[model samples]
Structures are given as structure tokens and as C-alpha cells.
Target chain A: MSPQSPNTKSLVEVRELTKTFNGLTAVDHISFDIYEGEILGLLGPNGAGKTTTIHMLLDIVSPSSGNVLFGGKNLRHHREEILRQINFASSHIAMPFSLTVEENLEIFGRLYEVPHRKTRIEQVLEELEMTSLRSKLARTLSSGQMTRLSLAKAFLTQPRLLLLDEPTASLDPDIADKTRTLVREYQRRFACTILYTSHNMKEMEHMSDRIIFLNRGKIVATGTAQEITAKFGQRDLEDVFLTVARNG
Target chain B: MNGNRIHALILRHLYLYKRSLPRLMEIFYWPLLDLVVWGFITVYLGQFESGLPHIAAFFIGALILWDILFRAQQGITISFLEEIWSRNLMNLFASPLKPGEFLAATIIISFCKVVAVLIVSVFVAWAFYSFNLFVLGVSLIPFILNLIIMGWSIGILTTAIIMRYGQEAEVMAWGMVFIFQPVSCVFYPVSVLPGFLQTVAHVIPAAHVFEGMRAVITNDGFPLPELMWASGLNALYLLASILWFHHIYDVVKAKGILVRVGE
Candidate 1:
């Protein structure tokens, strides 16, 4: 059960969020809410605007016409404050290539104004078992190690809401499990809301408390993994994912 | 521009530049190569060109000044491409940065790159040609203003094209830049150049600055007062670049061109 409640303090609230690319619509009238401490999984296939949605949430891609509220305040009006409380992690986008893993972490930590940034960076490095690779350039890291460093940046601020995009998409089975355990532990330790997106059904089943199915550009279904499986008359979230993405 | 934010961004790019050993070497790499190749050519021609004292001095300053101004814009191309390669261009716009902040950082970083090339060219010129640019310098303020506005004027337009298009436009920018160089009084005095060519030289703002600087420093000629005139043109170019860039950014963004893959 989540320690933070829906009524406690909602961290992120999206109202009729819609993003249009030229004449075509990418994310069409999507709406959702992330409470103070809950793991909200956004699942969809390729080109489903999953990344675009995340971009909108992060205020990178402006919405065509909608409002995103963080802490009950408008994102457009209080972007600086809202951004300070949010951090994103992904393996696809690399940090400064010239800076070592540790240096990259320190720069972002300072940007977020994290208290005792070095101490926090070291803690996260150890937490992710990335302490040994801290001295290496971020560009030099193998995919798995770079993912860990990106995670380290995500957790550097221990943000109010952590947005992740298929973070373990390419990790080995062993490292993937370790990453899942780290996510669980991170949530337990920090009490921040986590909004994750992945196509890995098993990973989502294991890591998410609730999963949202996004198809085309709409939220077609949302429920706990078991509930979604049972309600869709499917054996697993993957089957339900196919049903929603293809049929509905 | 929020000086501190631009400072941070400049530090970020310069720091990244420092990390790549080959790249850092390349900063001095091409200009040094240019100096060696051209210096040898100049040596071969020095005896013949020496008869026209003003033309000879013009060649020396032009050699270094054009290299500085041109190489500075080179940094702009690489920096934007760097962001593109890393996919962090998307990430940067997500930050608390406006377009002005980003533009200012690009200009400042470009200026810093100019300074880097300046150091190398100055040292090499002093060593090889005994061409001390300091001895031939004008009022420090206008001199810097001239180079800065000239560089950024071109830099923004070049960057705007890159942002709107891609590396293909970069080659176009390079071609147009040098097209003006030959006619901009970089190699010979306006007087020596043919009538039509001299008119083209007079039209280029850099020609005015270069010719004026040569006149002041070498000929001890009457004050040219070209600064105010050149500044007017540069200011217009700067305004047009910023607006044109902003308009391109908005049009591309609204049309969703900025989000295209590999764009």
C-alpha cells in the first residue's frame, strides 16, 4: 500500500492534456493524476506518444492546450519551483560526455540545488553499485553502467516525482532484477512519486502498483496488474496491452 | 540573458570541448595548419608585396582577423551538433531556459573560441611574420565590438539555419563566409582591387573594419570613423538574426519540425 494518499497531496495532475504535431494529433486529450507517493506505469507500443507524453510532463514539449499542475500549482506559472522538485532518468539520452560519471552527477545535483550533493551522489552511486565506475567518462560506460549513472542522476535530488522511460529496457536479466529491486527500495527510502513507462510486462507487473494502458493517444485502461489481467480476461498485463493497443 | 545562466551554459560547452583530446587539439589544429601553409606562401610573395607597405600590412592583419572571426562560428556548428548527437537538445529546452538565454550562450561560447584561436594566431604571427597585432590595434572597445557583432551576426544566422535545417546548411554557411573573404579586403587593399571588386569590398562591413584598421595602424591615415557606420550595419544584422532565428524556431516548433527524428 502506498504511504501517501490521493487526498494527502497530489504531486502531479494533468487536465485534458493534449499534444498535436502539426495537423496530426500525437497525444489526444490525455488526462491523468499522480498522487504524492504512487508508481504510475504508462504502457504503450512504439509511436504511441509515450515519449511525447513524458516530454509534455517535463515541460519540454509544450501541450497544444491544457494545464499540468504540480503541487496544485500551474506548471506554466511555477515551472522553476515545480522543476526543482522533479527529475527524469533515461538511458537513451546521455549526459555530458566529457564529464565523468561522478562529474555529470555533481553538475545536475548542483543544478537541482541538492543539499550536500557529493554525499548524495556517493550514496546513490553505492546504492546502484556504480561507485567503482564513478571515475569513468559517461560516454565510456557500457549500456548497463550508463543506465545506472542516469539513474544516479534521477535519484540525486530524490525528487517529489521521478519520471522514468523504459529504464531497464536493455539490461541483462540479473541487472534488470537488481534495477527493479533498486526502484522498490528507492520508493521505500525516499517516499517520492514514480511515474514509469515500459513495455516489459513482467517488469511492470513487478514494479508498478498500478498500470495505465495508452493506445494511439488515449488512456484506454488503467488498474492494478492483477485487476487489469482479470478484467480483460487475459492471463497477464502483456495480453491486455495487446488487446488495448490493437482492439481498443 | 541572465549572465550567470549563460555563464553556466558556456562553461558546460567549453568544459565539454576540453574533454575531447582530439577536439581540443583541433581548436589550434586547423588555424595552425592554415598559418603554416599560408605563411610559407606569404614568405614567397613577401619580396614582391613589400613595395606596397599598406597592402603588406593589410595582408598580415587580415590573415589573423579572418581566422579568428571564422573559427569562432565553427564552435557554434559543433556545439549545436553535439546537442543533437546526444539528444540533449530536447533536454535543454525542457530546462528553465528561454531562447534568449540559449542564444546568448552560443554567442559567448563562440567568442571564447575566437579568443582561443586569437591566442594561437597571435603567438604564431609574432613568431613567423613578426606581425604584432597589438602594435596595429585600435581602441580596444570598438575593436572588440566590431569582431563580436560581426561574429555573432553571422553566428546566429548560421545557427538559425542549422537549427532549421541540418549540417547541409553548415556547408552553405562556410561557402558564403569565404565568398566575402576574398572581396572583403582580407588579401589586398580596396585601392588595388578592381573597381567592381572594391565596391563589393566597401559593401562588406568587415571590409570597412579591416580597411579602417589598416589605415589607422599602418598608414597613420586620417581617422576613418568607420566604427559608427559598421556598428549600424552590425546592429541591423544582429536584430535581423535574432528575430529571424526566433521566427524560424517558432515556425519549426509550431510545425513540429524541431521534433523530427535526426533533426
Candidate 2:
């Protein structure tokens, strides 16, 4: 029931994107299209270049050779404009420790030039159930609360492109489930494109509309969870992931 | 490029000082302590060094101005290091905050910090040794500006090095200034150094600044030519430092080191 039309255009176009560090390649000539309003899960095992691909999309890491186009605009020439429509969140990084949660959110909101910031911040806080912790220092927050805050910051801008790296990693099951639901709800309400990465196979099956399986900086498979599992003659996506990760 | 975004960047650092008691204490306390310690040393030395006139003002004023330069440089470097410490550099760079805006905000924040440290040092010098840095009057403005510019140049270079080499180069944040100190001729005159070192010191804007300071304190009139030389040299250094930072920034991006900085 997405608002996107059957003829919806791609939001992100990656053409032979590759990244090499020193003598080693992290992402090797990967090409894909993320359609508007689709959840594209970049799935892979450790050192599969999943994170490196995400970094390229975010322009945090440069490609050794290739191009990424957002809305038909070249990322090299239109980075700030393209990035304005993109937002990213990760549990691996934390906000400034001394600033309160509200302060942190407010600062990020201002940086993004989010309109109606006060109302937007409050709405995001309420949506994430972080209203009570708004005044608490970011450093003092529990891990679960910090994850919630990270999600809140991502949702604050109502971005057209959302990049998330292991958004639910290390979360308790209850909170992880809730986080997934929140992400789904945010996507539903905003119809934003999501490029999500996670080690949780179940989460991938549940969340991603299409999955790209990468191994050793190359894409080994691309399909829906059921499609991938069926192609590999496996009962589930986890088995398919194990097959690809182990053999490739 | 964006004013509001730059303000947000500054606000992040300001909030750190606001909430942290130790951070606030460190700002005013260290300068005060340095002034007190140096003031007593000057007093003790003044009784023995009768050959040098206005030796007390020269030493005390030199200490305060030197601290100004150090604090200005540390303000930017330490604030950037804080981002690394808090694992916030990636977040800031990823946002709409352009690198130039980030540098501008850091410079403004550095000015605020140096002013705080300068005020405390000046107050302590006046209270303890009756050293009035303002006696040099309007010429003092150029001296302060020249030293701050030089400090910022060094700071920009230090940050670029840290960005390129990661946390391993963090020691440069504190150590780099003292490397310039000897060449800067902060505590002594350029002539006191050997001829070769004096040649090296002349290239440093701070050498001219200290020379100007000593000239003013000894009733030699405002060192206009020295101020002009310091200003011209510092302008070049500031431009070079900024270019160095941008160069390193490009390299850091290509190398994919930004995300791994704090770790």
C-alpha cells in the first residue's frame, strides 16, 4: 500500500561503485538501483563490504572509480543538495556527551535546517518514546535510550533517503522489535527510501523488500528473501546467507 | 558557509564548557596559576637583573601574551579533539556543516576561549606584579591579533596532521606550540639566539611579535615596523595553514579515515 506509483523512478543509482583501501578492495564494482519507497537491505557477513558500500552512498568514503546518482543528479557535483535529502544513523557512533538529548536533537535539527524545529523535535521525541529523556545528558543515557535517540535524529529531517547501519544491533529483543516497528512506521508515514544493513537475518527477511548479498566486496546475490532462499534451495534466508558467505 | 550550522557547531562546544565544572575551571585556573608562578619568578629575578630595565613588565607581559597564543591554539585543537573523543566528527561532517564553516566556528570558539584566558592572565598580572599590558595601548591590539593569527595557523596545521595520521598524532596538539616557542622567542630576544637560529626565528611571526613587545615595554616606542612584519608573515601562514587543512581533508576523504578517526 505504498504511495509510490508502479512507475516510480529510482532514488539512488549506483554505477560500478568500487572502493579500495591500500592494496585491498572493500567494495568492488557494485551497481544497483534503489527505487523510490523501497527498503533495500545490503546484507553480508563480516568484511563483505556492506558497510563500505553504505559509506560510499553517504559520501563518507570516496569510490576508487564509479558514480552514484541521486534523483538523476551526480553526487560529485550535487553532494550537498543530494545529501540534504539523505540522513544516516548508526549505533556505532554517539552524539556529544555533554549535551542533553534535547540539545543534541535541536543542534542536529538546526544543522539540517529542519523547519518547525521545536514541534518537529517534540514529535520525533514522542514517536520514539524519548520525551521523558529529552533533558537527560546523552552520555548518561542507557544503550537502549541512545539507540532510540539515534533513530529520533534520523527521523527528524523526514529524509527522502535514509541510510541505517545495524540500527538494531546489540539491542534487547523487545527494544529491537520496537525499533523495527518504528522504522516501518516512519517509512510508511513518510514513504522514504531506506538502505538498511544488519547482521540479523530475521530482521532482513522482515524488513527488506529486496536484498543484496555481498561477499568479499562483491555482490554474490540479489533478490527477495524468499527468492534468494528458493534459488539456493534453502528453507530460509539465514541458510542462503550462510551458503553465500561460506562458499563465496 | 551556513551561519546557523556554524552556530550549532559552536553551541556544541559551548555546552561542554557550560556543563563541565572541571572544563570551566581549567580555562581560568591554569592561566591564573601560570601568571602567579611567572610573576613570582619575575619578582625574584628583577632583584638580581638590574641591567635590564622594565624586566618585570617584559617578562610578565610576555607570559600573558604567550598564554593568549597558546590558549587560542588549544581552543581549536582541543575542541576538535573533543569531537574525536565523543565520536562526533563523523556526525558533524555528514551533516550540512561544510568544512569551511566548521573551521570558521572553531576559530570563533578559539577566540572566545583565548579571550577568557587572556582576561584571567591580565587580571592576575595586574594584581600580582602591577604589569599593565594595556600600557602599550592601541599597539597592543595588533600584537594580540598577530599572535592569535599565528596560533590559529599552528592550530590548523596540527588539526590537519591529526586528521591525516589519526589519534597517534594527537600529541602534536599540545607539543606543536612549544616547538614554535623557541623559534618564537617568547621568553628572550631573537638576538640572544645563535645567528642560524635567529634566521629561523625571523621566519616565525611570533619572533617579531615578542621583539615588538619588548621594544614597547622598554620605552622604545611602538614597534610599528615589527608589527607590520609580523602581520604580513602571519597572513601568509594563516593562508598556508588553511590550504594545508583543505589538502589533508581531501586526502582523509579519499583514504576513508573520517569514520575511523575516534576509534
Candidate 3:
């Protein structure tokens, strides 16, 4: 992984973002910056606001008391302008099941207005090793193939800021490793900044240049994997996660 | 609104229709069934009364026009429900596609579906029962346009309700348009309704449209005032429904309903 420079630009600036449901606060007034060209892993247990934070960044969920700025423009005011350069993928979300793999990507490519859309779709499919599944319906794919297809969409636009929430949650170890390697290589090649969340601590350690740990809707730790491990007096990220999850 | 984005959304649904037999069959099934059943019923009634041909025209014409409204509304609502069922709403919203662009695409799709159903109904009505829909002449355009606009209004409002409330409110997609049917006077004159319902029917754009259709068939000259009222009411309802949808969209985003909408 490339070292993140202190002077590096922040691709996404989330300030005092909070989301409340009924009487429950899903995310508190937490603030963070995802520097350009760095893989920032958002670590949290279930219901710890990891997905909620990602949603706020994508503007899929509105923040109750704060704002998110992408490329120095407020997301609320410049939604389409900013979102054109950004993309998101999650295993929990899906494409039109009845549509074929090529058809789905064709739609998204046009949606993002990617120039030379046809070539880009073929390139993404080949890069994700999904060329064989191009004509197959999305509903016919296995869980692992579906995850790859979602990743293929994330990679399709070569988005500057890709927010992926548990993207590899359903993938097997072999494919999951390849996905991580592919993401790292893509970030290195394109200088794409990613805000990634996953339950796999080892994968988090392997992929992230910096990590933000959240618990109970608040930021608990922010550093490199080793730094967080030492800060929490734990052996590694998994132990640190356990410490936070059990104690909080 | 970007034209490319809107085209992409429409293309997505087109791909679905192209691939699925059941979905393709849906475009022709309901409208044809309604036309055939009503054609035979009108024929049966014609055998019993003298000069019932005009009455038969009213029944068949109303059936065709009412189907236009129902199909138009279904085109928008069912298209939205497809996204929900497939869990693809987030993908579209997360892209550069704006809410207006999304609605524009769906409205275009609805218009296309309405055209398809109209062609089928027009052909069958002329072929089977010798009842010509074109007898309404150029006034037919505005009548059809009015009903479509009203359908879009109701469809947009239903989509807003479902967006805020999630799948639990999906029943409204099919049922909501029917709620306006009685007041719409699709099969009878508004005067036959209760006094309060007659008053209610006056405000509905479809009600004026049906009344206008009957006047034209009965050689009552052009129903200018009725068409004017229908147009004015449609403008209000369409504007209000669009505004309501935008408002509910914000509410859904604020409450995080988008995350769990399909589930």
C-alpha cells in the first residue's frame, strides 16, 4: 500500500454527521476525512453506524445535523455533479435481477455517462474475470459471482471516490483475496480514494492504509492497523474489535 | 435533466421487457381482456334495446379510456415496484441520476405503454364491435392526454407514499388509482352518483374527461368547458403530486428509509 501523505487532499470531508431513527441515534456527530488515493477502512460491529456513515457520504441517507463535502462541494447542493465522479457497491444491494450482466453494466455505464461506454464495460468485465458471465442474467449468478458483479460495477466508472460497504461479505476466501488485491491495484493505478467497510479484520489490516473504528455511533479509534492495535493494547485489529465490541 | 441518464433508465426497463416473457405478456394481457369482455357485453346489451348503439359506444369508449388511465398509472407504479422488488433503488439513486430525471424516464415509459394499449384497444374496438373510437375526432387527443396526466398524478403520489413507508404501502400502487375510479365516472354519468360524490367528481380531472367523452359521442358539440376544467384540474394535481414526491423523497432520505425500502 502507498503511504498517505499528511499534505494529501481529502477527497471526502464528512463533518459533524449525525443520523437519528425515531429516538435512537444511529450515528453521532462524528467527523473524518478520507484522503485521496488511500484505502480508508471503516471498522465497526453491526449497528455501530458503519453503514449509516457510508449512506450519509453517498447521500442515500440524509444527515440530521451535518453535511458531507465531496471535492470541496456540498453534497446536498451539488449532488449530481459530485455523484457523477463517485460510485458505491454493497452485497446487500442488487442490480435488476432479470437483466443480464452486460445489460446491467450497460445501464450503469450510461448512467455515469462514461465515455466509450462499450469498451469500458468489456474492460471491467474482463478485469473482474466476469467476461464469461456477461450474457448471463444477474439472478442466475451465485452469491460469489454476484459479489464480483457488484465489484465490477464499482470498478466500471473507475470512480474517484468509491464507497463500498461489506463488498466482499459473501465471497469465499480465494475470490475475496483476489478482490482485495484488485482493489489495491486499482487504487494504486488510478489513485482512487475508497471508503470501505467489512467485518473481516485481517482483510482490513491487509487493505487499509488508515482505519476509523466506530462503536455505539461514535469514533473510538483512528490510525493505521498497527497503531490502533497498539493504542487499544490489543494484539491486532480483531482483538481491538473484540475489545470495543465487548466493552462498549 | 441529463438526457443520457433518462435514456439509460428507460433502457434498463426495456431490457427487462425484452428478456422476460411474463413481463412482455403483461403489456397486452389486461387491456385486451378488458376490451374483449366489454365488447361482448355491449353487443349482448345492444340485442335487447332499440338505438342502444350510442349507449354501446359510451360503454366501449369509456372502457377504452378508463384502460388508458389504468395502464398509464400502472406503467409508472409497476416500474417503480420492479426496482423495489429487485433492490436496485440504491444503485440508481447513488448515481448521477436526479429525481426529476427518474420521473421523466418513468413518465416516458408510461406514455409508451399507454400508446401500445391504445393501439390494441382501437384496433379491437373497430374490428369486433364496429364501434369507432376516432369518432371523437381531434378532441380524442386531449381526452386521452387528460386521463394520462391524471394517471401520472395518482401514480406519482402512490410512489411517494411507498417510498416513505416501504413495502408495507406497496398495495397502494394498484389500489390507489381504483380509489379515484368511482368519482372518475368511468362507466356512468356523474349525476347518477350521490350528491356529495357528484361534487367530489367535479374536481377530478378524469370525471370531466368521461363527461366530455359522452357529450361528444351524443353530438353535443365540443365540450370546451369540460375539457378546460379537466386541463386546469390536471395541472394542479400533476404539480401537487410532483411536489409531494420530491418532499417524500427528502423525508425518506432523512429517515434512512432508502436503506431498507425493498426489504
Candidate DockQ values, in order, are 0.35, 0.78, 0.92
Q: Residue B41: error of model 2 in Å?
A: 0.6
Task: Please provide, for model 3 over B100-139, each residue's C-alpha lDDT reduced to its tens digit, 9 standing for 90 to 100.
Answer: 8999999999999899989988988998888889987888
lDDT of 3 at A119: 94
- When sorted by DockQ, best at the front, the candidate numbers are 3, 2, 1
Question: Which pairs of residues clash in candidate 1, taking residues 3 or more apart in a chain or in different chains?
Answer: none
- The local distance difference test score of each candidate is 0.75, 0.89, 0.90
Local error of candidate 1 at residue A160 (angstroms):
1.7
Model 1 chain A lowest lDDT segment of ten: A1-10
* CAPRI quality of model 3: high
Regions of model 1 farther than 4 Å from truth? A2-8, B1-7, B49-51, B167-176, B179-183, B189-204, B218-224, B251-263
Question: For residues B67-122, what per-residue lDDT tens digits would candidate 2 score against the true structure?
Answer: 88998898879888999999998888877677788899999999999888888887
Interface RMSD of 2: 1.0
Regions of candidate 3 where Cα sits further than 4 Å from its true position: A1-4, B50-53
Question: What residue pairs are clashing in model 3?
Answer: none
* Residue B37 in model 2: lDDT: 87
Looking at candidate 3 chain B, the ten consecutive residues that score lowest on lDDT are B48-57
- Cα displacement (angstroms), candidate 2, residue B141, comes to 0.7
**Structural similarity of chain A in candidate 1, as TM-score:** 0.94
Chain A TM per prediction: 0.94, 0.96, 0.96
